[model samples]
Target chain A: MAAGNRRVDVEEVNGVTVAKFTDKKILDEGNIQLIGNQLFSLVDEDRRMKIVLDFSNVEYLSSAALGKLITMDKKVKSINGKLRFCSIRSDILEVFKITRLDKLFTIKENQEQALDGI
Target chain B: MRTLPSSKVMSSSDDLTEEFEVLIPSDTTAGHEVQERIIGHLQTRNYHERDVFGVRLALEEALVNAIKHGNGMDPAKQVRIYCRVDSIKIRIEIEDQGPGFQIEDVPDPTADENLERPCGRGIMLMRAFMSLIEYNATGNCVILEKGRTIEEAEANDD
Candidate 1:
């Protein structure tokens, strides 16, 4: 199934295709892989290069999920595409900060900023 | 008869020790369920949401490490978890049926040289979220603890 049909909702904002994850809690391992594959499908299966992940709804995500974000970033970078994240809750933001992934990814405070930055 | 995965929530008569234990195959789905259950119990106990999230994050990372890195995702292997919560703090122990790793050898994830690498963040996140983290001599078992002062717990209770 497509990301839009699954845990994420896909749309275009300022010409950037954004996948807003609907899942509020993302700590589960299967949810991690499902979201990862959903994001991957956006690049590999759907051929959409530039994307932003709107994490406004996610309260918590596991490190494995964070690892998937890294993998997604690498995948998009390999194809000269872009991927950004926005609306990360403070709790989830702590994970990014602690792991120092905040330095590696383009993290925005909101969807508009993510679209503009990406 | 085949042994199935099992989980239990136990509270001693004094209510000082609330513990849960689960034994499951090295499957991500099963691991996910156990993690959720543990977190749910913590939330029900009125742990601060942020603290609950912190422990939840650390717990999931440890479970992932035990299931994926430790057990190599072998369904035949088992990952055992024990979580104990009290007014003062919560403690969790995770052990995997796999060859242990060297703790000192695990690289620092926040180091500049390893910043972009995705492999080492789990341990770092676990350390950051939990107050104390200990690895067994063999490295197959990890003990994670986060403390809330009695005052803090009572404050939350109020």
Candidate 2:
């Protein structure tokens, strides 16, 4: 049997790529590696740099996962690409605010807005 | 299941009578859920909202460092957290089984070029969240303290 809660799906929309994470724990290294590998592959493929990480599927994120996102953003920017986030829950948003990362990333209310922002 | 460093362990015989313990698997994803549980516990004890937030952030940072850096994603290593809460303050100690590194070697996240980078911010956040942050001589143990007093917390708020 599979772990129903520990899944992540990556897809493309309107030339913008979206990584929808559905893991019970978003902070662990295994899950981080999954997202990181996919994002890295996207960068390598010369796919759309405008990326949207849909957190609506994630209940919570650990600092490690946040670090992974920051690293991914930097990696994308190095290749003339950008990464944005959308559909974040309020509780997780508070984590962003507390870490002052809310000021650094371009966060949108939904995937369409995130895609539009780029 | 492994025992923590002697200095980091606070047995019931210690001066502090109140203690809290939580066992979390040494996986990255477990960090957030454990953090939420810890914050929920703190709230039940009437900890100030801001203080609760601070403790949660600090714990998240430390636990990530332990699980990711210390344990290196090895599930065999477990993060054992022990906290002591008193009327005046809260002290949290986290231990990991991985070989430790020097605290001074970590780069400052606020440094100009590093500001845009992601990995080093955990230590910076930990320092900002706790009033007193220190590592045991072996470096496998980390101790973080936040004040419970109104004045101290207010000072931290700024």
Best by TM-score: 1
TM-score, candidate number 2: 0.65
| lDDT of each residue in A1-118, candidate 2, tens digit only | 1344335576878778888877644655566777666666667775567778888877656667777777777778888887889999776787676566777787899888888958
lDDT per residue (tens digit) for residues B59-91 in model 2: 877987888789987977789887777656788
Model 1 has a DockQ score of 0.60
Give per-residue CA lDDT, model 1, range B123-152, as digits (tens). Answer: 888888889999999999999999863345
In model 1, how well does chain A match by TM-score? 0.92
List clashing residue pairs in candidate 2: A27-B28, A27-B29, A28-B28, A28-B29
Which CAPRI tier for candidate 2? acceptable
Question: How much is the lDDT of residue B98 in candidate 2?
Answer: 84
lDDT of 1 at B39: 74
TM per candidate: 0.85, 0.65
lDDT of 2: 0.73
Best by lDDT: 1
Model 1, span A19-70: residue lDDT tens: 9988987767667778888888888888787899999889878767777888
Question: TM-score of B chain for each model?
Answer: 0.85, 0.77
